[model samples]
Target: MWKNKHITFFITGGIAVYKVVELIRTFQKAGAEIRVAMTKTAMQFVGKSTFQTISKHPVQTDLFDQTTSAAVAHVELADWTDLAIVAPATANIMSKMANGMADDFVSTTLLALSVPVIVVPAMNVHMWNNAATQRNIQTLRNDNIQVMDPDNGPLAEGYSGKGRFPSNDEIFNYIVEQTEDVDNSKLAKLRGKKVLITAGGTREYIDPVRYISNKSSGKMGYALAKVAQENGAVVTLISANVKLPIPAGIDVIQVETVEELAQAVQTQFVSTDVFIMAAAVSDYRPVHFVDHKIKKSADSANLTLELEETTDILKSLKSRRTKQIVVGFAAETNDLLNNAKKKLDSKGADIIVANDVSQSDIGFGSEDNAVTILQHNATNIKVAKANKQIIAKKVLEVIVKRLS
Candidate 1:
């Protein structure tokens, strides 16, 4: 997607400035011509020469650089840019962008550009969570700006949080997705709707240090959440032991055990217009919880654990649902259609998505998937193997029709 593209990096003051150097290199490697515009405070962390050396273009530090060849330096660069990326976009810069304050070279250039702009925010957890910062982010989104959600990880302040800079691969993929031609008419199909999605594999703990989990990477669930949000649904994601970055503008509740996931979903299911159970929840858990890790036996080599059934969240919700459309997923090794049909009937779901996880290429941790959507008295919709995002879009199309 970057081929022959004129991409500009709008660098800002943040500890993650050094990380942008690698991101610039990644774009260049993908055949994009890169230039950088940095704030004066940004230069404090990384030298202008470093970006110049890496981007192979003079870093624009001043809006009025007399040495520049163009009549208006910022306007010239803004006109040249096909895409603008604000890496390590500080809360300060985001506030400026949201409010159209162009005090510095980066903000001024960004304001002049008509091209697609992606703001990658990185800052202290508290600052990222501040009501003012969140309002600014929403304002940018409302203005049709793409604000990439920050990753959840250890922060520079010696603690872990959600304001960490996302990995380069994530930013790259997001750029590719955002650049693709999309049906604008479908974007707001779910306006004013509430969507609740479950993701990842639930972990059933046997002891303090040991547990059982599945191969679910939570990609599909996360994809569903992203697509739902793009369609203007207020999304809530119940994530079960997933490491994926949280999608922007969605409420996320992290869970480990089936019980925890059940609680989270049940809490939100009441007000949800659509509920998607994409999580690979554990069917069973150890009946007895061990406070400590079990030790290796000296005499007997065998150890047995008693297991009990977990709550069937979908079936349990069937009786309580009124206007809500419940979707369930059946991951089957054999008899995919038959199993899915059975689940659709027994679980009383509006839609049952079934996939052959037995295949090694798709399902369970794969980025791509193929699924059959089963609905009562309706022909099954077979979605060919495709990226999880595409699959998500297709699934939501069907759901939106039912909603209409």
Candidate 2:
């Protein structure tokens, strides 16, 4: 949370500019001092008064304004702000910025910033993937400019794609994280570390035709991986039966069974600094798997199949792990603290997420989870049900702090 910050929203020529008004207001209400600068084409989408009303400052758009000295208004605005964020950054504007073509006031002001600059690109999916635009985006990043990937959703181009501007909350979080001190970030305490995480649900084969599985959505694992990446760790994600989108900037290894997951983790555990087993691995599987789907018979009375133990991936990792940080999760129905403490010692994890399973809204496929983070020392802390993203951040911070 930025208690008081300065955020300059540079509105570029794109139809998505309309959404920026609310973003400006969000910043202002968060105790941030905001200023706006719009491109000439942006005015065609939103009026200047709309921004001026929320920012409480004249929307600066002209390179030459009477209120300012002979200096370029664009350069002056860029030099004056604490942070620069360009929203609805058109492909053309992106190309121009990459090439240092500050022809307009908005682009020019952006080129002069000494503080952190965030570029939120919005354009047609095709243009977004164009070689030229991508080169510009990469060039900007190579020059230390932060580019927030566009959201994948409905676009003004009449279809859905990755060109949609990110939500106000997403952009806000990025800015706050970028500006926060290293000690306060998830990375300050975690940089240069290695992490391995398990995600999704494990499948147990009953026969050739059917399998048993849980409702583990893997949202928590993905969130933890993302936060771990932010904390500057080398992250490898081991997944099972996950239908979720692949996370960007992580090494993802897909698996379908507990055996495969155990193999993956064991193969990669030697140098890992942190291991987070958040998956809902299957406990039992058929002792003798059917080669083919069993057919029904008219005289059939009953059927029985012996079940066997699935590999405990976390425990194996713990045995082989000496200096690495091992963390596990316990999805429980009752005796939450008791079960959690058991796992903390049994799994050899440095920490365990002990959660009550009776709350349908906060576990196994829910966006939120209520957990008591139990440590190896039997010390425990109850974290109320909250968004998975927030929980992941908190967990990452705790690990980093303990390590520090």
Candidate 3:
């Protein structure tokens, strides 16, 4: 995906500096041309010669080096780069960049660049949490720079916390999403559209303390919300009980049961341009409700509880939907395509995304997924096993085609 892209990598002093090597190599293997720049402090942790050998380009350290007579070194490099990434961006350098200080090569080039910049911070837990550092990070974000949050784990300070650098694969995925060379017209295809998305699994209560729910982690729905918002949709997320963090710039309404979820969707339906029902609504609920915990008795070892069918949320919306596009999801253990087709018709959905929950690796609670999209009057599209984020992007692409 990164073929022929010009990526400039900047390194700073941190124990996580070693991880930048693998990041450069990953970009190199993807056929991207890479250039390296380092701070004088970064040289202490990783050698300049090491980066020079890996990148096959001279590492820029001195701001005034006259080796390239074409133009100023920083400006020349800045113009050459398609994108800039600062790995192990310490608090010091981030502050400089945030405050428009151009005393060094990295900061000077960053200030001069017209391309996107991605900052990956790595520092001690306390330093990362400090108020001043956070302010600088927010300032950079306000300037439209992409600042990736650091992962939580063991740090070089011999303690476990939230300042560890993320894995190379995660970093690579971010790069791919930001720099795939797609046309600008296709990037924000859903701009000015209002998207309503339901996520997670609804809980059908048996009592105040007990309920029934599914294994849905809400990852897929959250992914769709994120991708849709990134595509310039005004997203409203009606979520169930999922522990994931809410995406920025989304209007979120939290609900716990099927009825509550239905109500929230109905309230937002009028203003929605597109609706995605990604939640796993319970099929049945206990016929009776117990206000208090049921006491266990030794005399009755066998217990039987009656269940009644719950309202089908998607079918209920069919009559109410006017010009809005409706999408649904089906999690079936068998007959995936047939079931999805049935759902696509019965629910009156524009598309039904079906997946096999029988698989151990790529369904329910997993980071990856494989799905087949079923739609009327359109060819079925199958997305092979991949990260949910990638699958979400493909799903949006299909939706864009339909919308256009």
- What TM-score goes with each of the models? 0.56, 0.58, 0.58
Q: Decide which is better by lDDT, 1 or 3.
A: 1
Q: Give candidate 3's whole-model lDDT.
A: 0.87
Please give, for residues 292-372, the per-residue lDDT of candidate 1 as tens digits. Answer: 989999998998999989999999997888999999999999989998999999998999999999887786888778889
lDDT of each: 0.88, 0.80, 0.87
- Best to worst by lDDT, what's the order? 1, 3, 2
Candidate that beats the other on TM-score, 1 or 2, i.e. the better one: 2
lDDT of 2 by residue, 103-190 (tens): 8777777777667788889998999989988899999999988898998999886789888888889988887787665433334667
RMSD, each candidate, Å? Answer: 18.4, 17.5, 17.7
What is the clash tally of candidate 2? 1
Q: What does the lDDT read for residue 76 in candidate 2? A: 46
In model 1, the number of clashes is 0
